[model samples]
Target: MPAIPTDAVRVADVAARIGGSVRGDAGRLVSGVASLASATISDLSYFSGNRRGIQPDKTSAGVVLCQSKHQDALPSGAVLILVPNPQSAFVDVLEWLFPRSEPTKCIDPCAHIHPTADLADDVTVGAHVVIGAGCRIASGVRIGPGCILGENISIGSDTELIARVTVMNHCEIGARCVIQPGAVIGSDGFGLINEQGRWRRVPQLGRVVIGDDVDIGANTTIDRGALDDTRIDNGAKLDNLIQVAHNVEIGAHSAIAGCAGLAGSSVVGKYCTLGGGVGLAGHLTLVDGVHITGMSMVTRSIRQPGVYSAGTPLDTNDNWHKNAARFKQLERIAHRVQALETGLNALRKNDEENL
Candidate 1:
């Protein structure tokens, strides 16, 4: 982090930069960005919503990015960058302050590429990368060090495969896809059968089809299907350490967070959001617009569009033990209640007959 600046910037400069208005002191200098808790005299902080209780009042920040409605809550003499959306303005400032590195066009001599591999004019292949025969790498594609591409793989234009990415044979990755380090696509599906207690291997013959503008996070694995292709639709984002099993179909624009697992043959609908550590069972269907919270175990198909959650929060051992005990007796308690209901019905019938 850089030190906070002491030279104050004019409120008109910031307003022109992001097309917003200044609500307070234009002379206050915002030299650095910081949290509301640790902000110094030259630091700038922002409050997104009503979540920050007392931190905004006691902060020493020279400037704050806040909505127009919250202008009166700021400390006296503090500079305000009034905007309709404070977070969006903060993002613009962060991007301006910290720009990303541009890709350098360079190919190492140590990379092993087949003579028939078609690399575009501006492609960059890093050291020790193996591009197999019949591979077509498009323009602006960057293959990082130690990546392995199997034969006949077609990587679309402007796609980037980071270090040690493995794309197996016959897979098709669409344009502008970003595959992070250690991601394995088109791996063999888990298919086997026991013949008289002896296991028999079932070969996976399907391909992995990844659509355009997809981002596969580091160390995620998508298995090849047994007899059909496993498809990932356009604009889908997958987080690190996720597993997509054989023949699974993920619809367009769905976002799955880290450590989530989808079992074989499951069909997830469009625009669905899955939180971290969510597990979807095999052969089930998740309809469109389903939002599952973190650490949920999904065992059945969800047909409606709504938020769903399960799993108990962390608790003390004593309380957890009591809860577990009560949970185990629920079936017996239900059976006893059914028996009592039946007895009451019989008594009511006998009283009617006697009358």
Candidate 2:
């Protein structure tokens, strides 16, 4: 684990870094960051919303980052940085306080690189990494320990593949991307045809193309297409354990949460969000700005941009059983109600004719 910095920063310097103004004494020293509930006099904490149920008066933080709406809620003599977006500004401050160390630019002796492989200056190949023939690694790229790159793979500049990542044949990873550990890119898609009770495997000839600034989570598996490329567009964020099937096109800036499964050939439009455990059937389309809640199942195409959800609310087992049993009798109940209405109408007509 990397050590946290012991150095302290002035309250005024932190405000200047995030383009905010200091409200209290600017000379106070902030040595670390902590949560609002556990803050001390040496720690800086932030309050962005009331959803966390934080009490501002109980906090003993040296500095607090907050929006203008919550400034009056703070205790007296509290040092503060007022920003438009406290979360984003706090992220910037965190990055400024702790920067990542650059890896040494050298190929490990135990690694196997083919003679025909091309690598630019300043590339770092870690221990036991296997680079097949015709692979191209650009400058400032760090291939971590035990990574395997298949033939004809192209990795762009400044991309970091943390330990044990596997990129199979002919795939292309764009610049400034962070692929977490155990992510398998360009694996064969689940394409099979049934022939006389035996499964015949279809050839996967396409690649998995990842765009710039993409962050793929740990253990996420992206399959190669059967005939075309499976693409993840720029700035899209995919969480852990996501299964992106063959030929699926995820639009730019779309975010899919953990355990979400997108079936083959599904086109997700830009800025869409799918919550955890959401499953979409094959060959469907979700329009831009669509939001699907957690554990929802999408069975058809969504042409309009809006929030959609489908799942039964939870209930006790006894009540659920009664409701479910009544639900199964709906067709029979409707037929009986229609017959009763018809008989009543006939009786009313006979009485009117006699009068």
Candidate 3:
């Protein structure tokens, strides 16, 4: 059985709800969503043309969401819903069918709240959560169980801090932001000064300022700045296990994938995308719309807007070793070539003189 409950919905009604146009029978009834390969006659499905082994003509789904290019490929028995973004429209259908249950606005009895902390009347604070002094929580805010909020921290309206999340002192989170489980915000920067044989720790005096509609993934650690604030602009999405070092300024609408690490003082421009395991060295900048491929290490600042990739491609172990050895002898081989060129030049001069 499917985990999601199936509902009898009309094709035209769903099209109106998702802002799409229907090409076939609008009166057709679809019960639920499924993939093209597994769709039944009563189900709805989407084809994005990128997935392998999924053909629109072979699908048995009654209602389908797809682009105009793939509409002709649909079987005559199926109903095609024309949309620019098929995946997004499918998600809208899912939301329309299965509405999320709203959390009750009530503070848990086991939670701890400081006397100076300010909370809205409709805020929800869960069990074992701690709200420190000078903290402000806006309306429609939900703090999940086992969360900790430090002093002078302000959470905007409708922001959700998921289970076991920690927000340290002087941090601000904007409205409609979702912080996933185990995320640590406003942690101290790794600033240390080497004095003789001893290392002196520098105080991290800044905060993390997160903008509205930002999504921080689980277990991601965003360190506070050494002096200024570490800022993540609106609509920025961070994947799980990402390390954002001190004073990193991530521009608006930038998406960073899992395990990506940004060192201190790095600035990423707006609409930039960083693939998984990408590393940005300290004090560098990336221009707008710059895309870095997975596992690439960026040491220099990027001034252009295009997809960039580094690191060697995969090869056999023996071939890689041979290539590495050859690369090491190039300088010596160039000197020998230079010596032969010099001797050849001397002989050519003597022949020309004799002529």
> Candidate 2, which segments miss by more than 4 Å at Cα?
1-4, 326-355
The lDDT of each candidate is 0.89, 0.92, 0.94
**Clash count of each predicted structure:** 1, 0, 0
**Two-way lDDT contest, 2 vs 3, winner:** 3
Per-candidate TM-scores read: 0.88, 0.91, 0.90
Best by TM-score: 2
For residues 71-151, what per-residue lDDT tens digits would candidate 2 score against the true structure?
Answer: 888777679899999989988888899888889899999999999999998999999999999999998999999999999
Q: Positional deviation of 83 in candidate 3, in angstroms?
A: 1.8
Give the Å shift of residue 206 in candidate 3. 0.9
Question: In model 3, which regions exceed 4 Å deviation?
Answer: 1-6, 52-58, 326-355
Model 3: lDDT to the true structure? 0.94
- Per-residue accuracy of model 1 over 45-120 as CA lDDT, tens digit each: 7877668355577777777788888877778767888888888987887666556565788788999999999999
Q: Give RMSD to native, each candidate.
A: 3.0, 3.1, 3.0
**Candidate 3 worst ten-residue window by lDDT:** 1-10
